[model samples]
Target: MSMREVDPPRPSPARVYDYLLGGRHNSKVDRDAAERVMRLWPVRELALANRRFLIAAVRRLTREFGVRQFIDIGSGLPTEQNVHQVAAPDSRVLYVDNDALVVAEGGNLLDGRQAGYIEGDLRDPHRIITHPETSRLIDPTVPTALMIIGMMHYITDADDPAGIIRDLMVHLAPGSFLVVSTATDTLPDEMRQAIDMYYRNPAAPLVWRSRETVERFFDGLEPVSPGLTAVEKWTDSEAAAGPWLVIAGMARKP
Candidate 1:
């Protein structure tokens, strides 16, 4: 009998993140990837903190700033307390992700009325900005929240993540918001071993950046309260000062 060829399982960042969040959508490869990263860092806690920051930012935008539209680019697999759920009932959201599984799952999870999911690459900001779902849900003339949570580190310097932000923001009206969270390069040598692990695994390798490099991604925008801070500290005034593994911030395009 001839043996059939079997392709290897590829670990997706979205699925790895879902695994870290204790979601059931991830495959075995993603679970292994998350577990390997957990050996060097508190991957699960970091994921929770990032999700909290996103929730807080979205709430602030909807309640305090009166933002009715959201474009969450690189938005991962949906879990509890999604943007449209946390936002005002009348608000509309468009969740964009490059991962096919993420897009498909998100489409199934969200109501097409208030929220929609589409396939989009972070490097191609224009396509997302002008996507049909974005056009249907987001008003370019009004303030919108543009969120890129826990995904920017996947975009290497050659991809020009800063430029992507600028291009996306250029299409939004003044007072629009930008919320971002990314891995920091402040990890100790021992902890940095996880970076190599990702590179070797069937998962997406990250390009961790210094605080300075990340700050540049918000150039020409006004920082929200607390400014750029650790993800755990972004929403909590009493959260301990960091040597944190992940950092996040919210800014407004003035």
Candidate 2:
């Protein structure tokens, strides 16, 4: 049998994203997948823009809202200025992802005192919220930031993405925050077709949602200033306006 058949390394969503962000911790399979998507879409820009938004949101929560702990679900490979790095020195961060490689690599980079990593799927909020590492790093009694950035597009409607957000939010105390970023259903037909074809894998299909549908993910929460907007526009007013393929929002539990 061919080596490909003997042991094929499937492209990991997190690793592909890492590659798109120009990180060095991606495999050939991941780089190949990211380059393929890059040809079809501006995924590199989307990834960088999304990371900038994430840093801004975390800084907002830490500096403005006085939030000291964070639970970042669907967190990808460890990169510069990660949530823990952006937050205060005393703040704690719990990173969760479905990819074992991501979890393992992230765990290795963490100091273990202020940050921790767990292998958990986004669809199973209870397991993630209740995991020992989550319990150890996060205090549910105090406000915490829950970030689900750049990964919601993979959670199709059938997965009830809104319901998952609600389930996770129920565990945090009042004044906690929810930060989300996802792909918008505003891609041109040619671009959309290209993306659709690239992400046709049964396990990691992309599912773009309308702006209204994406906003509904923040239902029952108090939206931060600027509300839901394009990823680049989230924190920078000077950033060019949309037709952006990705949008982001930050909200607080009342």
Candidate 3:
């Protein structure tokens, strides 16, 4: 489907994330859902922390690891300082998401740029990895960075999130980087209850994992410094001191 198609009135995970990040791309349904979530936990702060983690990881990949290609799976609505914006201007980025609104909005944001958007689901990594746009922009034999930020928790065990990551990584060259941040089940009662509110939406139910389960997503890679820390603690920025409910880490394929 093309961008001209009007999306249905369901609350999209991307739009809900946009609302949490104070972006204007969300609809009334998203805003209402976000407000409901905020009443239970520090959703805005957590979202901002995750965003900061993504920026830090991308900067590290471009500056330290010399990675010029990026595939952001489950990349949501474009916000301030997107992946391509954070990396070098010459870097190539392909934003992938199943949400129609995300694909439409991301395509608009990436207009005339080296970056592009693919409307694909993470459960089917082969489709995303082998898509023509992905092939056109990203060379599979070259080192690339993959960002799975803020999306994995929605993928339950039935979907085999670890297998999904492994399948995607198999197509990437050695030395490729994987940056991931996922929600954990180790939250307080109130926070858990708040997260449960999201289940009310027809969208995928949140599948909070334990720290051990989340770490399994990085199975074949070596963790970067300060391995699998909270999103706020992933870097030494001021945002590192903020409260975060998600664990984030960066690893390199061997």
Which sections of candidate 3 miss by over 4 Å?
1-8, 199-203, 237-244
Q: What's the TM for model 3? A: 0.91
lDDT of 1: 0.82
Superposing all C-alpha atoms, what RMSD in Å does each candidate have to the true structure? 4.2, 3.5, 2.7
Candidate 2: stretches off by over 4 Å: 1-8
Give the alpha carbon lDDT tens digit for every residue of 1-254 in model 2: 22233222877777777777878767788788888878877768778889999999998998899999899988886676678878889999989988776777778778758898899999999999888888888889999999999889889899999999999999999999999998888967767676666466777688888999998999999999778988889868987778858889999999
Q: Please, what are the lDDT tens digits per residue for candidate 3 over residues 1-254?
A: 33235454777777788888878777788889899899878888888878988999998999999999999988887667779889898899999998776787778877546899989999999999889999899998999999999888779799999999999999999999999998887767788777677644445677878888988999979999878878888766444532336889899999
Per-model TM-score on C-alpha atoms: 0.89, 0.91, 0.91
Candidate 3 positional error at 186, Å: 0.3
Tell me the TM-score of model 1: 0.89
Q: What is the per-residue lDDT of model 1 for residues 1-254, given as tens digits with 9 covering 90 to 100? A: 11112112777777787778777777778788889889887768878888889889988888789998998888886666768878899988989998776787768777658788999998888788778888888889999999989878788898888998999999999999999988889867666686567644445566889999999999999999888988989767898868767889999999
The candidate that achieves the highest TM-score relative to the unseen native structure: 2
What is each predicted model's overall lDDT from 0 to 1?
0.82, 0.84, 0.84
- Please report how far candidate 3 places residue 142 from its true position, in Å: 1.0
Q: Worst ten-residue run, lDDT, model 3?
A: 235-244
User: For residue 133, what is the lDDT in candidate 3?
Assistant: 97
